[model samples]
Target: MSHHSKAKQLLQQRDELDEKVKELLLVLETNNSTMDSPLVDAEGYPLNTIDVYAVRHARHDLICLRNDRAQWTEKIVEEMEQDEEKMGESAPIEEKPVHRTSNEPFVKVSSVVELSPADVGGFRKEDLIIQYGNLHHGNFKNMQQVAEITKEYENKTIRVTVIRDHRPVRLEISPKKWSGPGLLGCNIVPIAGANV
Candidate 1:
């Protein structure tokens, strides 16, 4: 099969895996449980309120599906890289001016509470926040600005851009009431010496 065809097939598989992960997450939510939530009581007995069996199964499935997705993603990337290499061999490359900006990442995500808005929005720990709604490295002043923005866009989706593993990932997060204390339920700290 061609590289393009392989990439397309991998992408479809990844999408299907994502859907399965979402379904498992819903099952966990229905049981009022997070991945780390204890299924047993203090005395080592299964909790009476939650369906421990279902939750355990959902969590296990989620883990497996996530691993599958990661492998699919790597395969897709490899296929795309091969395609790029083939194209580069046939065409002359044109150099474009690189625009360098001093706008560095201002805030770093320290933690994300499971099942919270941030978690649901795909926020991960150690993610460097380059943009949060209208706040960016150039205009961001402090954590207070982030708080204000979150309050202003309550229940509304806000575009968030973070650098994870040296790649930019964009996410839409809405601050809303949940089982967590804060809207985001994520801790962010300003980067030292970073322009805010």
Candidate 2:
């Protein structure tokens, strides 16, 4: 297959892996919450052991899949860069749908309110915000920039790049006033030692 086709396939597989990871997380959360008692079905058949074991197995599979996806993503980027070089390009530049490879923790999501834009946009707990629209890299000044941008672009869709469990996931979030308090309804804190 061509590099482009392979990259597309890898991206699709990565997205599927991400969804599986999310589902596994839900399973783990459910199992943990019911640790005091056995999980049961409609007929009250005990399913705690099965549920826990399934979650554990899913977690292991999630790790392997995430690693594979990460490698594929890297290979795709490398292939793209090589293609660009062949076209006389000497430097790698940021393009639309930017995939950040930075390990610099910019912000850590503290909380996400239910039914909010952040929650609706798949912002989960412990997500590391790498970039959001114009808040990428050295563009953002502080953590308050997220709120400022959200309020400024209320009801407009913007790209948000985040790292969850060492994987980069880009999300599009429309800032809007739902039936809640804030526009995005998410609380985030700057990472320690980051130039906030």
Candidate 3:
């Protein structure tokens, strides 16, 4: 996500919390007797201070929750991202490419020269179909179509149209392939405008 978009979301969340804080403050500051909702103490008389402190506690909790959200949503995303980059460089052993599950949209091909090594890892012929990437068919259609396009693209750039949950959408996935295996050894799903 872009910095501007994140800033906008944080600003909106902060504004909403501020409005809630103001509303709670107004309710606590009220001196009218009729607004009391039968709240009573040991003596059976209405407890005004009791209600005041309750609202105060709620306001305090809201403030704490907002602070926690700011710490995680604003300050933590960048730090975690940096950690990921550092980890990527300093790993102890040679890394192997990990392919997504059949349930996801990602695709991969084995290295032709190192086909045995790639095959020994995790990829399999049955694991090659492109589907919604960790998403269901109904929540959104466009991304599922992306999966279809990714599969069909194989090692060449291509466009595709797919019916996700009965809605049609178009997507284009970049051309990426394993030259060693010479076409990834998987039968790619055919989509629109494909040369078959």
Candidate 4:
């Protein structure tokens, strides 16, 4: 396969695997934090023993998936670099900032406060905010742009586009006054300025 196609495939696979890992981690956390062990059954039945083996099995799977994803990501970066080198040799082109593509720019979620609008909206750490309502990719030049856009739509449900685990996800977020430090209760840093 071509370098670009291969890279794209790897990226998609890595993203999917990353998402699965995250979900599995959450499941592990839930299972581990229980006050008392409870049996999980696919159908209603006499309670079966919830064993440590199930959690251990999930943990093992998560580790293997993460390791595979890391290796694939390394391959993708190498392939991308090779493609860039070939393009540069063919013609002179200005190097641009990474993550600031022609597509919608994204912001990385740096922190999220508990019980905040962001938490309610299901925003997670490392989520990439791609669009906020009408704010297109080119419309954002800095982190402040995102804050302003959210403020404008405060108390209203707004459609938000985000890149989570390398996949595009649409979420309806309503930024409003809550018992938190801010309306959204989340901190987002500009991706263009970050190492990622």
Which structure among the candidates has the greatest lDDT?
1
The local distance difference test score of each candidate is 0.78, 0.69, 0.40, 0.67
* Cα lDDT tens digits for candidate 2, 119-158: 9999988887777776765565686787787888798777
Model number with the top TM-score = 2
Q: Write the per-residue lDDT of candidate 3 for residues 1-196, one digit (tens) a residue.
A: 3544554565566567667766655665563222334456679876756564565566566668656554444333343334444556443353332222212233322222335322333234323323322232233344345455446655553432222221223233333455444333333332332110
The C-alpha TM-scores of every prediction are 0.48, 0.52, 0.26, 0.46
Q: What are the per-residue Cα lDDT tens digits for candidate 4 across 1-196?
A: 3877876888888878878888877776766623233445567552444445666667778769867865775566556656666666432244331332333445678899988998898888778776666664566666677778788879976666566664556577889999877789888787774322
Question: Following a full C-alpha superposition, what root-mean-square deviation does model 4 have from the true structure?
Answer: 13.2
Pairs with steric clashes in candidate 4: none
lDDT of 1 by residue, 5-68 (tens): 9888877777778788889899999989999999999999999989999999999998888667
Stretches of model 4 off by over 4 angstroms after superposition:
1-101, 193-196
Alpha carbon deviation, residue 79, candidate 4 (Å): 27
lDDT of 4: 0.67
* Stretches of candidate 3 exceeding 4 Å from the true structure: 1-50, 89-141, 145-196
Clashes of 4: 0
lDDT of 4 at 159: 65
